[model samples]
Target: MTISKRTLIIYLVSLGAFILAVFYFIKTNELRRALKLSEENRDSIIYALNQRSKKMSELDSLLLTGDYNSALKGYKDQLASSDSSSFDLIQQRIELTKKFIQQSRRVVNVDSVNQDTISMDTLAENTRRPTAEEIRNYDSLSFALRKYQIQLDRLKSQLQKKSYGEYLTFSSKKGNSVHYVGQVQNGKANGHGIALLNTGSRYEGEWKDNLRHGEGKFYWPDGEYYIGEYKDDLRSGVGTYYWPNGEKFVGEWQNDQRSGQGTFYNEKGEIVAKGVWKKDELVRVEEK
Candidate 1:
């Protein structure tokens, strides 16, 4: 049978309209997806920018406060994570921090050395012989004086570096506070540095894994001090312990105790004892 012209024309027009609708729907969906993806990318970029800005602001604050250690750490972290374009700037910041730290250390070292020399001179000048009571109570008096000196030294150090405090302060597990100025690695005191304990004690020397290792000088608040070697935080190897009254012990040590061959001198610089030692006691006296 022959189809009507009107019917054929209507059917073709209807089919074209349906095809157009399907094409429009597909294109619209694709456009919506592209727009969503672009929005997500934009948000990510903004978040990253905000984070970078925050980090930079924190670094600036650390530098301004003279917290060089923290500032250096922050810069290093940034350098590790940043792109090549920022490498030069970050590296420069790291170098500047390092120089500042080195200069500060030099100043501290000179001041400490001068103070130590002066103290030694004063001790040398006191040539008065000890009385009966002074000799009998020398041990107790020396310990008390050393304790007092620790407090005094801590105060002095604080006053001297008030403006440019170039140290890191932290508290120990036992609620004691410690102020450290020096090289740090893996968040622990390492390399050369100085540590001031709240107990009126000070240590200046090499460290490893937060422990006193290698050579170092330890001072009490009083005029007593020790120059020695250490391992695992214990006094080891050769060392000298000096008292304010001009007495000194030079000897080998193990586990913080006097051991092996050693010499003990009186305030008059006379040798009181010279021999092998065990746990700080002279075991065998050698003829001088």
Candidate 2:
């Protein structure tokens, strides 16, 4: 097989082109795989972000409700100690308390709940401190409560003055009663506030038209409690309900009923049921 120079050159060129074609095919496949994986990762991040945002919103709303509830309860305790029955004083104090609750909502609403983005520019400001603003709010409520106390004291000193004494009031709570100090608009509980009932029940959270329409916490006298989102006064969203004995339910809710993906844990923290729920019962039993 003695080949001429021209023939050798021709054969070499054909072999080189074939090798290049093979390499190009492999490289193209690799690039496609990389692109497909990147796209999948992006989708996963987006899905995760959406889920996290919703959960964060629910939590933020719940916490705002809690803070307002605590502040109002504290103020109510102060009012009771002063034996202050002054309707005018109570109303004035309520107005002041409303300011703080309003401030808390504003502070909590600004938190963003996005994570998993690889972009260097999206700095995670996910965890935040709600302290200083909360303190200022607490002080505002406290000041108002102290004013109510002083007014009661002044009325006591003026007992001899019938005109001044007549304006003061006193209450010896007659029955197991609960107290609530929060926003009331148009004769209905609206916005954030706390409630303590005579039956030893307590609720603190947002209200709309006198219904618990947002995130809130409800505690029974027995120490059982539900903390989560509410819609139209029903436990209609994601939340956690804990029994006094350490049992708990965590997941979706609809009309005060357990619905959607939820799990029930026994007193010992063992999962009793987990899966899709309907009317408070598990529809699909998930394998542990």
In angstroms, the error of model 2 at 211 is 0.5
TM-score of each: 0.43, 0.42
Query: RMSD of candidate 2 to the true fold?
Result: 30.0
Cα deviation at 129, candidate 2, in Å, is 68
lDDT of 2 by residue, 107-220 (tens): 331112222222234323332333455445445544554554455445433331221111111111344433444555665566776555545456678777656789999877
Each prediction's RMSD to truth? 32.0, 30.0
* Per-residue accuracy of model 1 over 156-180 as CA lDDT, tens digit each: 3443333122346676445567666
Q: What global local distance difference test value does model 2 have?
A: 0.58
State, as a TM-score between 0 and 1, how close model 1 is to the true structure.
0.43
